[model samples]
Target chain A: MPNKNLVGIFDSDEKMLHAAQKAKDLGLSASDAYTPFPIHGIDEILELKPSILPKVCFFGGATGLLTAFTLQYWVHAVYWPMNIGGKSFTAYPAMVPICFELTVLFAGVSTFFAFLFLRGMHPFKTSPFWGLQTENNKFALVFDLESESKAEKVSSLLNQEGALEIREIIE
Target chain B: MTTATASSEILRPPLVEGGKTYGQITDDICAPMEKRPPLGWFVAFTVAGLALLWGVIMVTDLIWTGVGTWGLNKTVSWGFAITDFVFWVGIGHAGTLISAILLLFRQKWRTAINRSAEAMTIFAVMCAGLNPLLHMGRIWRGLYWLFPYYPNTMGPLFVNFRSPLLWDVFAVSTYLTISLLFWYMGLLPDLATAAAHAKGAIRRFIFRTLSLGWSGSARTWRNHEKASLLLAGLATPLVLSVHTVVSMDFACAIVPGWHSTIFPPFFVAGAIFSGFAMVLTLLTLSREFLGFKDYITLKHIDAMAKVTLLTSMIVSMAYLTETLIGWYSANTFERFYFINAATGPYRYCYWTQMLCNVVAPQFFWFKKFRRSPVVAFIISIFINIGMWLERFNIIVIGLHRDFLTSSWTMYHPTYVDWGLLIGLFGLFFTCFLLFSRSLPMIAMSEIKHVLSSEKHGEKQHA
Candidate 1:
C-alpha cells in the first residue's frame, strides 16, 4: 500500500467511475474511489474480484436442507416411530416444507454475516475514511500515489482535470 | 424572494415534461384526488368501515358461538371463509410478485403498480389472515398453531410440520413479513422526499419518525439499494413458496379430484393470473379517479395486461392438465369428480370460470384492447369472478361428493356467507381508499429512477 495521503475530487460520479476504471485497466495497485452515492460498477472498476457471499449462501442453504432432513428423520423415523394412520416413517414428501423454510432462513442469515465480513463492518469501529460529506453532496476519488511528490502531482492533476475541490485526508 | 433565492441553486430540478420525481409527482398525482369533495370520501369510508366492523362482529359471534352459527358443515367445511382466504391471498401475490419479480427482470413499467400492489398485498394478507382464525372452532387456540403451547392439549401440541396447514402458516407469515419489509424499504426514499417538501409540525414529526433521520446520503442510498435487492431476492422465493404451500393443501390430500402433482405450479400460475387482473382493476380506477394518466400511462396497462394474458394461458393449461391427469390416472372416482365439476349442479360456476379466466383474457392478445382501460377493467372484474368460481369449484365439488354414495350431498353458501363475502369487498376497498389518501400510491422514487429524461445525454444502457 502507498503510504502517502492522497485524495482527488471529481465533478461527478461518472468521472470518478471512469478514473477508477482507468486505474484498473493500467494494472495499478493501491487505489480507492469515493462518491456521493454508489456508482454501480465501482468494485469491478477497482478489479476487486467476486465476493465469497454466493459460496457462503450456497453452503448455508445446503446446511439448512441437511439439518431439516436429519431432524425430521430423527423425530419421525427413529425417536418415537409411531405407526400413526399407517403413514410411512421415512416420509420424504412431508419434509419438503420445513426443508424449504430452513433453507431460506439459513441462506438469509448467513448472507447477512458474510456481507458484514466482506465489508469489514464492525459495530464499534468508526470508518477509517471520513468523507461523510460524500454521503450527501460530493463525489470523491482517493488515490494512493507512492511518494509525497507523486501525491502532490495527483492532487494537482485532479484540480486541472476539473475537480471542484481536493483535500488530503490523514488518519 | 430571498427565501426563493436561498433555495434557487438547490436546482429546481427541471421538470421532465411527462415525468416527475418522487416529491414532485405526489402533488401532481394526489392533488387531483384530494381536491375531489371530502364528503364522498367520508361517505365511502363510513359505509365501508361499518361493513368491515359488522363482518368482524359476525366473525366474533361465530367464534363465540362455534362454527355451528355459520352454515359450514362436514359437506363443505371449507366454505366462503376459505374462498375468501384464497382470494385475498391470491390478490396479495400480485403486489409482491409485481414489485420483486419485475424489479429482478428489470421491467420499468412496474413503477406505476408496485406501490399500490404492495399496499394491496399487505391489506389482502390482513384479510386472508382472518380466515384461519375463524376456521378454527375455537379461535382462542390460534396460538397452538404458531407455538407448542396449548393448555390441556396433550403430548406437546405443536404445528404439524407434515401438514399442509403448517406449510401455509410458515409460508404466509414469511411472505407477509418479506412483503412488509420490501414495501417499507421502497417507501423510505419517497418518504424522505416527502419530508423535504413538507412544512408543518405534524409533517416534520411524522416524517422524522418514519424516515429515521434519512438524508438521501450516498452511503444510505448504497445500503438502501443493496437491502432492497436482497429483499427482492428473498421475496421472489417467498412468493412462490406461499402459493405452492397453498396448493399443497389440496395436492397432499388423497381426495379424488384434489390429489395431483401439477397443483402447485397450477395454483401459483392462477394466483399470478388473478393477482394481475385485480391489479389492473385497481390501477385503472385509481388512475382515472386520481388523474394520474401520465404517471400510470396506457403503456403500463398494456404491460400488465400482457402479464395477465400470459398467466391466463398458464392457468388455462393447468385446467387442461387436471382434466388430462384425471383421465390418465384412470381412477373412476377422480374422473367422476372432474366430470361432476364440469357438468354437475356447479356447472355454471365451472363454465363461468373457464370463460372468464381462460377466454376473457384472450382479448388482450389484441394490442388495441390491451391498452384500453375500459376493456382491461371489465376483463379484470371477470377474472375476479372466475377466480372465486374456481375456488368454489375446487373446494365444493371435490369434497361434496365422497367415495361413499350415501355421503354425497349438495353444498351451498348461506346468506351470511355471501354477505361476509360482499362485506369483505367493503373491507378491501376501505383499506385501499385509505392508502390512496394517506400515502404515495405510486412509487415516486422508483418512477424518478426510470424517468427517461434522466437518461438524456448519458444513456448508460443497463
Candidate 2:
C-alpha cells in the first residue's frame, strides 16, 4: 500500500476539538488540525509550544531605542551641532518622542514579520488542503498513516467522534 | 427564579442577528464583492472621482503658482489647509480607537465595524498628510529634508529634535504604518475565506496573494491571535501619542489660545468625538447602501453614539476650563483671547462650533435620538463641521490678533482653498467606496469566532 495522510472533516469546531483530544488519548499523533477559525485550547491537545514572539518584540524595541538615541546624538550633537535657543547638544528631552515612535515601529513591524516567519506563511505558498472548505465552516484533522490496519483504526475513531467525511491523500 | 433568568436572557441581545451560521455569514459578506456593485456605489464613486479630480487640479495650480494662491495673509499664514489637515487627522483617531482600544477591551461589537474604521484611519491620515506637503509649495525638493538621513552635501543637516513638527513627522508616519499593518493582519484570515469563495482565477489569485497562503491551522491561529493582541497593545498608546504630538504643534507655540496645558487631552477628546461622528456618518450610509443592517445594527450605532456623547462632554469641559483658566490667569493677552473667541469678530465661528459640537451631541443623551440612525447621522455631520471650525478658531483666530496690532488682518479662503477641502472629502469617499466594493467590509473570521462563542454561551445557559 502507498503511504497516505488521512483527513477527518467535521461540521463544527467542538466536534473537531473532541476528535483531536480523543486521538491524543488513543496515542495517535495528529499532524495538524485545521478549522474555519481558531479553536481555543486546541494547542494544548496538539502539544505545540507557545510562540516566543513577545521576546522578539522586546528585543526589537530595544534595538530601536538604541538606534534612535545614537542617530540623534551623533547627528545633532557630534556631527553638526548648532546653537538653537542655547539648548544643550544632548537635548535628551527632545529625543524622547522619536525614541518612543521608533520603539513602537520596530517592535510592531518585527513582531508581525516574526509571526509570519514562524508560521511559515507568505505570498503564493499553498496549503496541503487547498480548495477544501477548511477555511470556511468545515473543520479538518489530518494524520499520516502507512498501514491499512492503522488507517481503519483511525477512521473508526474519527467516525465514532462525529467526523462527517473520511478521505486519504496518497504521498 | 426561572422567570428572572429568562428575562435576563431576553435583555441580552444577540450581537450577530438572524442567527447566521459560518457559511451564511461568509456568503453574506463576500457575495457583494462577487456580484456587480449596486447603483448607489457607482453614483457615489463618480461623484467622489470628480471631487478628487478637482482637488488634484487645485493642488497642481497651487504648486505651480505659489502658496500665495491660498487665502493666507501675513498674520493668518496658517489657514484652510492646516485646519483641513488637523480635521482629517482627528477624524482618523476614531478608527484606531475602535480597532485597537476596543479590541484590547474585548469589546466584540468592534468586529462589525473595526475593519472599515481602520480603513478610514488610513485614508484620513492620507488626507491629512497631503495638506502639509501641499503647503510646502515645493514638495519634491523639500520632502526629503523632513527625514534625518545622513551623507547629504547640504551640511548633513539634522532635523530639529526639539521641534514638535519633527516629532509630528515621526509620530504620524509611525501611526500610519502601524495602522496599515494592524489592518492587513486582521484582513489575512478573511482574505483566505474570500479566496476560498472566489470562483474566477483572477479573484482567487488576488486574494490568495494578499492572504499569504493562510491556513486556519491551530498553531498559526494561536500565533496570529498573540501577534494581533500585541499589535493592539502597541497601537493603543501609539494612537494617543499621534494626536498628542499633533496637539504639541500648537501647544508648543506661545500664542494665547494655543499654549494651554489642556491642549493634549482636549485635542485627543475632540479627535475621538469628531472621529466617532465621521464613523457614524459612514457606517449609517454603508448600512443603507450595502444592506448590512443585520450586522451594523442599531445596537452598534447606539454604542458609538454613547462614545460620541462621552467625548463631547469632555470637549465642552475643556472649553469651559480654557475660558476659566484664561480669566484666572489675569493676563491681558490670555483673557483677551478668550473674550475675543466668544465675542470678537470670529464669535460666529466659535458659536457655530459650540452649537455643532457641544449642543448637537447632547441629544444623544436621549435614547430616542441615540438609537435613531437619522439623528446620529445628522449630528455626525454637525460634529464634523464643528471640529473643522474648532481647528480654525484655534489656528486662525489665535494668530490674527496676536501681540502686534499692525499685523492683525482678516482671513478669507480663496477658491482653491475651498476646492481642496471639498476635493478631500471626494477622495475619502472614493477610496472608501472602492474598498467596500472590493474587500469584505466586515471581518468574517472575527464574526465567525464570536458566533461560535455565542453558541457555546447559549448551550451553557440552556
Per-residue alpha-carbon lDDT of candidate 1 for residues A32-128, written as tens digits (9 for 90 to 100): 6644334566655555555456677778879978987887777678655767699998888888887887776666566655554545443333434
lDDT of 1: 0.72
CAPRI rating of model 2: medium
* Span of ten consecutive residues with least summed lDDT in model 2 chain B: B453-462
lDDT by residue for model 1 over B1-462, one digit each (tens)? 455544542443322346453335656744633355356567777888888877777766676677777677776678888888888899899998889988888766677789999999998898887787778877777776554343426564344567788778767876776677678777765554454455566764575457444444334445556656666787788788888899888888888778888988988898888999889999898878776788788878888999999999999998998898898889899999888988888888889999999999999999999989999999999999999889878988888886988878876666667667766887888998888886667776566555532433323321
Listed per model, the TM-scores of chain A against the true chain A are: 0.86, 0.92
Candidate 1: list runs displaced more than 4 Å. Answer: A1-80, A85-90, A105-171, B1-23, B26-43, B146-154, B452-454, B457-462
* Cα-lDDT of candidate 2: 0.90
Clashing pairs in 1: none
Error at A11, model 2, angstroms: 1.2
Q: What TM-score do all the candidates reach, one by one?
A: 0.79, 0.97
In the range A81-150, model 2's lDDT, one tens digit per residue, is 9888898889898899999999999999999999899988899798767766888889999888956787
For residue B79, what is the lDDT in candidate 1?
82
Error of 1 at B319 (Å): 2.1
lDDT tens digits, residues B369-462, model 2? 9899999999999999999999999999899898888888889899999988988998899899989989999998888888887766532210
